[model samples]
Target: MQRPPRPSAPRRRMPSPGTGLTPLLLAALAFAITALLTLGAYNSARHVAQANLQNTFEYRSRDAHLALVRRMAVYEEVLRGVQGYLRGSVNISRKEFADYFSVLRLDESFPGIEALGIASIIPPGQLERHEQAVRREGYASYTVHPPGPRPVYTSVTHIEPFNGRNLRAFGFDMFSEPVRRAAMEAARDTGQAAVTGKVVLVQESGWDNKPGVLMYLPVYRAGLPAQTVEQRRAAIFGWVYSPFRMNDLMRGLLGEHSGEVELRIYDGAQPGAEDLLYLSPGTAPGRRPMFQRTDVIEMRGRPWTVVFSSTPALEAQRDTVRPLVIGLTGIGVGFLLGVVVWLLASERGRALKLAEKMTLELRQSYIRIEAEQRRMRVILQNAYDAFVASDAKGRITDWNIKATQLFGWTEREALGRPISDLLVPPDQRERHVRGFRRFANCGSGPVMSAPTEVTAQRNDGSLVQVEVAVAALPTPDGYGASAFVRDITPRKEAEERERQRQQRLDETREALQRAQKLEAVGKLTGGVAHDFNNLLHIISANVQLVLRSPNKQQQRLQSILDAVERGSKLSAQLLAFARRQPLHPQVVDTARLIERMDSLLHRAAGEGVELRHTVQPGLWNTLVDPNQLENVLLNLVINARDAIEGRGSITIALSNADLDGDALPDPEMAPGQYVLATVSDTGRGMAPEVMERAFEPFFTTKPEGKGTGLGLSMAHGFVKQSGGHIQLASEVGRGTTVSIYLPRCLREIAEGVMTPGR
Candidate 1:
């Protein structure tokens, strides 16, 4: 069967973008997605840029705080050096201090400090002496000022670099001011560096009256322990102090980089107008900055809050190029990606329409294909013949269930086997192979293109006749073959039976004529033998009488006796073949009987032949003359020995047998249980003509006196009369086998003797 061709789908054109709602929806979706992505990018860029700017501001603020701390520490270090200088000596001179101050180069090395000086801690009792000492070292007018009565006085005694500002600081009572006094007292008590908070230095000019601070380090008397507060206070001699203007200090600390950030220093943690210490020059007055950072630094045991702020100009200096470029690029890419998606969606819409049309066509094609398949299946399943297909090489490629039923082989078992080898009988396989090759070469053969009767093999190895028709299957590459076979075994068997019946009829007519002749001869021979036996008795008595009378013919008379005895044996054989001999029948175990004759059979086989016997277990006893059965075995073996011209083997086997009516070994034999004795020889076998007449009387293949040939005939008669069968099979090169099947006895007969055909 051929498959129906599939139908193709019709193409449908996509609608224009302006005409459809789909394009508008896709455009809107693209716009929405792009807008969201652009906004997200911008926000991310802004956050990152702001964070970098904030970090820049914080770093600058920290730098400003560290600058302030380091400047303050420098001034304290100068003070401590002066304190050490003062405390190392009992008396001091103006030139001696000037030399020390000149070595410092305070104007270049340490800026922001206005002057460095010493304040002596004088008691009210020694105030006059301290004033006299200071006046001796400098101007004659110098005296401790702000002369209120107190228990102790800290008076500035020595100052440098001896400028106009240094003159003003000289002889000033620093302990009289609260800010300066607090710092000095702290220094005296703690024996550490201290600084005054938001002080107006006495040395500041009226035009430059900015807030200032003072640092003090106490110098105690030599050889005094200042480990405790009380000891430090008790041992305090004078103070080494520096005066500073906050504005100048910050300017000196920040140097050229001071404009990078706006800075303000407060005297304490809280910023106020009175406590404001310094502000950078670039800061706008009274204006807040864009970014601010604050740090509290510890100076001389006090907390100074330094505030650093980033102005607009400072923020502009921070990096902003990367975010700007990223934001623009993100918007551009988002728009391009959206456009691509829109175009793809448009194309997908056209493809979807085409696919829908194709689907409908495919659905129709599938329906047609399914219907065709169902029709083919019905024909293959219901047909009585077997349908088989094979490739050009004769390999079976397809087989239906009917093929399985006919060949006794399953589809799985048959496929892929060479068809000729699988189905053709051994004798016919070569011809089948030749036919296959002819068909392959020419696409035609005697068997192909026509129905023919052939013998085929079944899985069980039985041969069956079949009517087969083979046809070439046209293929693109070449040609294959398909066969339709119907089993004709039953009809062939009927024809065969008819042929055999006709042959049997002809043979039976001939056998009846031969029997009539043999029966007449047997009657004549019996009459003569009976008269001869009477004469032999008379002759034997007369011979004995003659011998006793000493006659001259005695030797001749003995030879006559020998000849008579041989004649008698020959007459007995003739009678046996004619079916007229009396037999002693008994229920006997044939296996035991054969076993008893083993030695005799071996001896009869002669020296050149090997004789063997096999008796099956549980053999049934047969109703036959035991003596006759022995004779039959001896005769068969002797004949087998003569057939072997050289070394050969004789095998005698006894077994029980049951044959059905259809499968009986001999047509003349009744179907029943029988015990079979088979004697076979590996020797020169007989031709078909000799095998056919092997049981005829006196039909010998040997030289004149070597064989009677009546041995098989006599055995045949005895078995037939005993209700059994005797059959022989031989192949020219293979060997010869004779089988004697005797009917099993159900019970022993009381008759001691019985005549055949009686």
Candidate 2:
């Protein structure tokens, strides 16, 4: 069912493009912010790189300064070594001084040192004595050099390896120079080692001159008090010193080539070019330096200003591309973010429009659903069959009046009650519950396979059979069921009556057919008996006539006995086949019958044949004519005896048997529990052709007049009429077995065996 369409709502206009914070404006803002942040990052990275470069430069410069200081200290130690040598002997000769200086091995042990010399502190009056004292050692020209007068003259008295450039400093007065004098004075006052400022050595004369420095250590008299400056000055014997070229000394510390940073050392506190004692090779001309720093280090008593700067190689090592990468990334991210925001806003507008359209459709759908529900309610209340609805948990949710009337319960009472508990039989409750559970858990189809029959209980505790058509009703919560139920008990009863009627008809037809078969057998045996009657009549007439003669009386009487026996057997076969023979059925134990007949059975089997009677214990009793059964057994024994001819064994076995219609050897026989009696012979067995006609009257495998062939025929007919079966099985070499199955009697056995009339 459907309802009328809902009224349409007025459409609202959408905002035009370039509305507040358009994509372009937003993009511009994003870019500006990102650019600002990127610039800040770039500045931060630059400052960090600068600081790092300066720190690296300072570390390298300080290392270089330490190397220089350490080298100077080693040279100072060399002078102290010389001073110690003199301390052992106060009056050392010039030859002794020369020997000691040569032993110092200045050239090999202390590389980069130009020379080692001893400076004697000569007073103004003792200058000539100092010179004469040094000239007497071998230098004829030895005299206090820089001959101008001074407050105190310190003269280089002894210079080792006094040849070559070192010969120039053999009598040089170091105290005459201000820088040299200052170092010597400091050594004397402090009684420690000292170094002079950058100076031109007196030995420098060639064009390849390098700036040089001197290290001095004061020597004092052995017993003088040298603790104070005055005492040190008064006790001063001389000074021991070594000179070093700045170029060679720096080379020993920094290697032959410049490194990542450039090094510049100034002799004094001022880093002025005039005072620059050493300058490393400048950086590549085109690439300017990036970082520079100045540091001061004490050179013994003086301070040297050391300047360090980044070279081209050092600048090349810095990471300068990070800032560019960050800037580019920021620009790309800003653009993408703006595009994303634009698309999101556009989609938001489209979503709003779509939602409005959907709202209209939804309202219309709700109206249609309400109309459909009204229609459903009308159909449900007035439905022909009982209608019931249940939830997923098998509890009733809806019940129409028809359902209430059918179940004898009102809707109010049925609602909220489990469907099984409300209407289902106790025996069927679990099964219905399982079906409903399958519906709920697996979302299966109908709970009862649709249009199924179920036995149900009414509200008054009465049972009713109902035909139920079930269907699954799917709701948002889960699965529920809708069912139409109708009473089927009357229909089921009529069907049962029809079935019983049909069964009765079938049984009657079968009985009629069995009667017909018996009639056919009776007809055949009667005709044959008629013909045999004529033959027996002739034989009887001849016997009666022969009885007149006394000579052949015994032969005629024997002939009469044979003829009468043949007639009696034939009549018996005809009576049994026609089902006209009288039968006295009683509960008889087969085992007991076999026991009573044992002697008789052996006698009938004759002396040449061995007769065996075997019976199982607990065998079931059978209802049959015991005399007829005894006759049947006797006939089987006689036949076995005849088949054996001279010597053989015959076995009669009795056992319990159970059979169904299919298992019965005779298809016409009924199925039930039975007592089986089997007679087996170890003799010439009948061939298939003979066995087929073995139950036919006047049919025989014996020589002429040997057998009437009515033995098995009578047994088969009588067994059939007594509601039992007869079976014959034989093989050419394995002999034959005839099994007779009699219906088992369900009542008590008779007390005594009856034969004949009884």
Candidate 3:
């Protein structure tokens, strides 16, 4: 039995080559390699596309910025020419000044200038000959009109002094007007040119319609000799004053589309703060100022405010390109990867067949790989994003298409260069490298899967947002890592925009809800007021009838009549609060209205508060019921006093505004003009929540007896009924500004004709 067992030992196991488990292992390895290569190729292509797009954007932005700067420089040159004549750096006779202005008008670019004039500060005696010449030549007419309450020096131009247009202005004296005097003082004090705030200036002596702002530049004796700083400057002999129409000036600087941009010029000479020299053609939308200041550095002591603007055009352009690049890169990489895998598989079985077939298959695979590589290179060359690869020791092994595109480096230039030297943000490099090492050791267990957003340095020394996904690769000797990065700047911006939109929606919803609630309260108050009026009338009538009776009953009836009369007055007030009574709207001067109600408002505000009225001179008249206006004033003062809780100040101001089509906040308004009545209070201000509900009927913050809450609601309804708008602005601690804008009358006053009664 033991001898027979020896025969079984001779049966040996056959070795299987390239079959079963071995083939399975080889296939799995090939799949893994193919997957890694495909991913790498795709990422490389993506990097290339992103980099190219970003470069194009940067180049375009720079070009636009430079163009704007050059345009502004041209504007400065034109301004300097005017400045030269004003400062007497260039001697310009009246004829010469007029000629210069005419030439400037011909250019058509400086449309902001309404008219140009030279006013001599030296008294009539000093410049009598010049004035006589002006009159004799018919360039300007000087008339000593009948002496009235105020001395009016009227200068009329038969022919436009500068451009020969028939423009005339009357009743203006160089020495008069506070704003003009201040401008002259500034010119002398600073020994340079000066500009004034929004002012009304006469354009053409006899013409009463044309008005504009004045820019005055002083003229000094050019050859004056001196030793000290003061001695070198000549005395203020005269000034070159230009009538720059506020709207026209803005239009000229911003072109015809001034509505798209906001322009503000700030004068630094004003002591308290910057004075607004100019506001563009239209006021800013959304009730908020768009741009703060666009300053012109003083060229020889003349500070000019050039153009300050907030435009959405540039920002929108910057945000549209990043995603496009990413998409293109992804498509290219996927296509190339499929080709590479197909070629590798096609070559696999041919290695042991015919030698020619093996060689041919190898060549085909090489050709396919090269083509894919070339495609990847082309994509990277065009991309705007930065792409980099590092070896196990953190040395830069590969810098693909996007890396060169974004960082301004080529593969030849960046290969073998330490990635830390160019790609790492200075402050984040150390931390990033540490994290990278951890990821490399752990196969992305800790930080690799985390979608980290970080800033990477570009070739131009700018930082860009990069969304990175990192993974580690293990080889025979060591480990390395690859980062898949996508430029996320546009995405971040999109998210921010969406957030703001949502916020605005929420705010709008809240405002609408508050408005609806207020409307409901108004209906209730109106019903109560109507019923109360009927009751008051009945009681009064019955009391009157009883008073007609004889004896002791008559005396009692008289007492009842007195009580009924008081009750009737109270009902009238309640009706007014409910805005249910008919209003007789007529042209009423807001200044006069405020003056008439001052005493009542003061009394209503009590001893702890001070009531002040700032009525603008030459205030525009508004069409509204005089009684209702007074009631509005009273209600506002009373509310303001209550808001203060004890002591504070209340100010009422009246002003005029030109509301153009682009200036309206609501789309329902028609363009033209308006008059503004403003009431401001220095009190514990209302929060956004409170202010939103302040106009709601019956929504009171005070105890039941203290407020009717219908006051503001009634005011809002009355204003709306009168074809006007009411806006309220308040902060938690910064008090409140309530403005009422009423349409302005289109009536024009005839020259030299007084009103029937005046």
Q: For this target, which candidate reaches the highest TM-score against the unseen true structure?
A: 1
Model 1 whole-model lDDT (C-alpha atoms): 0.73
lDDT per residue (tens digit) for residues 1-758 in model 2: 79989999989988887686697798788778777766775676566556655655655565566556666665654564465456412356668777766655556545688877778767667776667766676768877777787787777777777778887887788888899889989988876678899899888877777788888877776554554678777878788888878777776464322576687789988778678787775545454577777888888888988877777776775656654554555567436455345434644674576567546645654564465455456546765578888888888988988898889999899999998998988888888788677778755543322255668899999999987655455577678877777788778899999999999999999998899679757867576867687768868776776867878877877777777776676667778865677888777877877888888887888988878877888898888888888888898888888888568999999998887644677777777898899999998898999887788765678886687666777888889888888889998867899999888888885456453331
Candidate 1 structure quality by residue, lDDT tens digits, 415-524: 89998778978887887777777677666555432255778898999988887655565455456776767888888789899999989999999999899778756755
Per-residue error for 547 in candidate 1, Å, reads: 99
- Stretches off by above 4 angstroms in model 3 are 1-580, 606-608, 660-671, 732-734, 748-758
**Would you list the C-alpha lDDT of every candidate in the order shown?**
0.73, 0.74, 0.58
Candidate 2's C-alpha runs over 4 A off are 1-37, 88-111, 122-136, 148-153, 255-257, 271-273, 283-289, 334-758
Model 1 CA lDDT for position 633: 83
User: How close is every model to the real structure, measured as TM-score?
Assistant: 0.41, 0.38, 0.31
Which numbered prediction scores highest in lDDT against the true structure? 2
Model 3 accuracy (lDDT, Cα)? 0.58
Give candidates' CA RMSD values in order: 58.1, 55.8, 35.9
RMSD to native, candidate 1? 58.1
Q: How does residue 663 of candidate 2 score in lDDT?
A: 65
Candidate 2 RMSD to the correct structure: 55.8
Which 10 residues in a row give candidate 1 its minimum summed lDDT? 749-758
Better of 1 and 2 by lDDT: 2
67 Cα displacement, candidate 1 (Å): 1.8
